[model samples]
Target chain A: MAETIEMDDRTIAIGKNHKLFDVERIRADFPILHQRIHGKPLAYLDNAATSQKPKVVIDAISHYYQAQNANIHRGVYYLSEVATQAYEQARECVRSFLNAASTEEIIFTRGATEGINLVAHSYGRRFIQQGDEVIITTMDHHSNIVPWQILCEEKGAQLRVVPIDDHGELMMDEYASLLSAKTKLVAFGHISNSLGTINPIEKIIQMAHQVGAVVVVDGAQAAPHTPIDVQALDVDFYAFSGHKVFGPTGIGALYGKEKWLDAMPPYQGGGDMIKSVTLEKTIYNDLPYKFEAGTPHISGGIAMAKALDYVGQIGYPQIEAYENDLLNCATEALQKVDGLRIVGTAQHKASVVSFVLESVHPHDVGTILDREGIAIRTGHHCTQPVMDRFHIPATSRASFAFYNTKEEIDRLVEALHKVVRMFQ
Target chain B: MDTDLRDLYQEIILDHNKNPKNFHKLDPASHSAEGYNPLCGDKINVYLQVEDGKIVDIGFEGSGCAISKASASVMTTIVKNKTVEEVKALFEKFKGLVTGKVEPDMLELGKLAVFAGVRDYPSRAKCATLSWHTVMAALNSKEEQAIVSTE
Candidate 1:
């Protein structure tokens, strides 16, 4: 059940500094970071939206298209054999990446949005009956919110929103009060993309299970930052995006518990998803392939494996240690900026820092920062309810990746000073 | 100063953004409409006091970026005392100027030419046109609380 993992010099090398992580080498792997923007070196802090791909992942994609370009699963020729092996191997890669029980539980979709939609349409149509309750959080992305709304309307179910406190932490006491025997499903984000607040997902999952409600996690923001173990969490379904995890776009994975996968009907019906199709009736394929219909994103699937492996090589023990320091560094620096107020002050947070400056609109701040070659997201971040909760139109958010350095944080602060002076 | 920055945030634009002209509601406004850009959540409400088809007074009440605020401020200053037809014509010319289809005529447009630089930045083009569109919607009074989107 286990393969030998070789610990090479690359894995064992330890650096000396406030940051023991090798950020320089990590930054070198990403090609896009080499260029200059507006005559200034780029400080890419928009990690939450999407991460820049490393050269290895890019190369893997190109290699697949160039060397092994063939339809997988049914082909008998050499190229097809290689393609099938590559594709199936990637499935195993995903299984190992998430520590999922089996490859049958891993289904590839376009992105997290598609993954969640598949669950809502297929599972919600079956298990969620009339008068059933579906609970979600107020801080969820519109992608997570809208699908459930459509499902609830279709199923004649009620959608309850769990509120968040002033510090952007989910109101756990309020959440406990909301749950009851009527709640058939509970969907929540593992981390708030806008606020970067790490939620108590395990505790939430345990509570949901006690009431017989299946938990679906929106792990789009957490996949890149934290290590995921589906077996340990025992979450019914976990969805994540490829583009956010240093992988190619148009590809992502949804990990569903095998029992739930078997219980839920196929989301889409087409070729390669049928065991038998007569003139009279059709029998759907088994487990994962039933959900994944027709020609999938073959190259993207393989590239996602490469991206996961890239991060795995760095290891979470080292990555988390580095990110915590980076978060602290950025937070302290941002707090010192005049008229600046950090929005989410949760006790536990990731590398995202959201803030607003008095009398300065986020658009103006974004424009000024862009001139300085600093890329930060400026808007409601597709979390409109969260914006309403804070009573601000939008915020300037800077999200960090492993490649980000203290030097870049310094550049952001200097650029922010220019913004304040410009507004003054 | 960066040349592009100066072009984008001209002194006149900044001045208008800070203290926008005619930035208030008309109590008994004949025509009014709200404009919203969902992309950045920018909202602008244009209020017009038209007397016998002539825009006797015009004002706006809302919040947006400096470009949008300045564009609305400049619009009110130029279109006052103009007829409905003339205001519509001026809108067409202003749109053409900012989109780089027409050259700036400072003698005619006054400070509105400051927005001509918006053509270089396509995303900012919507910012330049949001308030103008709101006024057009207000003139053709379909609803009192009418809102149009710059999608």
Candidate 2:
């Protein structure tokens, strides 16, 4: 067992200066961080794309494959029973992680993309009707936007988009104005991947509920950084990917209120999701399995539970505090550089620092930074609507995790300084 | 992170990106076309001044990555003073080079061959091809079509 560090209310109130997170010790937990990329130590700043998994999560996957590799819920053998128990345990773990009411409310998905699609197809397709509107935000990932767009098109529903301001915060007034009797669903991301702005999801959900619209929160970005309490938030549906949260790539979870899930149609047709199949018709299984069709990523699901445990052990308050400090340090350092412009300065944000050097292309900045072994994502970041809103083609994004340190932020700043000088 | 800067950002490519040739809109041009890569938000407008069957003047104006800007600069340099057929062939050759269909020979490509490094990085191939694709669209355009293709 790893040693647990305690943080009292005073330490938490004082901000992230507490020594609960030793950068070197945290770095030791992630084996991939030790390597050199181009002769320089790898400074991974691309946590928004995906996070590096800890040894515990990795070992969980290996151990599952070694000891209990079997098909779940079908066979009556001991190994099968063990595998099924582990998988269901994972579901329960996810339920607790998201603060869902029951394990039946959680469904395993391929990733956040599939999770959104499942809700769009299963719930949106069934409840949404012609002339109805499904409101989404411009700051949403294409995963959240495209699925709803396809669903709206198929169902003859109108797709309404909530716009964002210059600072990349969603215009709450516009969202409220867009809501009406015709609005059937209001889908939004809990955190903006490109901008790193944490949306006011609780307020958004409450407003949508007031208008009798179901709320679907894309928790892909939020789940990795903050503690998610779905019950407290009162969201209708919440989706997140395990890979983003330092788990395996093939697994994710979708949390729905049991009432909504039970009322929705099955997402996909398969053997495990069936209760009884006849020549005339087939009866579908209950809540979660109705949406989880295929032989799930059994090992991935199990490992995801381990990843969540790792995050829980660290404590979200401490992690968020540390990450916020890194973000502030990075923002200040980059701002001191000549011709550097940091994008997305929202009042509330996570650890993403997206910036662009005047006259230096983001690709050039990214390439030059790579020489220093500083990994950053430089592109539109799949939020083209946000890019369009900014009137810029792309920006270099450096996202942080709890494991990141001020030393890494310094390295990134130094690399940015070098890149800006080279361009000048 | 050190995944071969030479493969993605060659020195010549960087130079061209910093100091792009024909980096202006050709006013009073016979043909013009805009190309957009939605994946990275790279947009470019290729302006061609075609006098008779030859491209007498070529220019471009847009904002994008180093690969895109360099590719556009090199594209204008290669296509200028060449016949329409020759320009088309050069486009095909450049496309083939970036897509790894053909190994770029510096002797054959002159300054434009520096983009051969882009072949190793598949995601940026579209960045290198944006200019060529835009030029092709410009050449093929009639008065009826204004926008060609936005990938």
User: Best-fitting candidate, measured by TM-score?
Assistant: 1
Q: Per-residue lDDT of B78-114 in model 1, one digit per residue for the tens?
A: 8999999998988888888788877767667767888
Q: Clash totals for all models, in order?
A: 0, 0
Off by over 4 Å in 2: A1-19, B1-15, B27-30, B92-103, B114-123, B140-151
TM-score of 1: 0.96
Task: List DockQ, one per candidate, in order.
Answer: 0.66, 0.54
Clashes of 1: 0
Minimum summed lDDT over a 10-residue window in model 1 chain A is located at A10-19
For model 2, residues B1-151, the per-residue Cα lDDT tens digits are 2337656666777788889999998888999999888767788888888989999999999999888998889888888899999988777777888889876666877777777777876777888888888888888988622565546
Please report, as a residue range, the 10-residue window in candidate 2 chain A with the lowest summed lDDT: A9-18
lDDT of 2 at A354: 90
Candidate 2, residues A180-285, lDDT tens digits: the string is 9998899999999999999998899999999899999899999889999999999999999999999999899999999999898898998789899999999999
lDDT of 2 at A49: 96
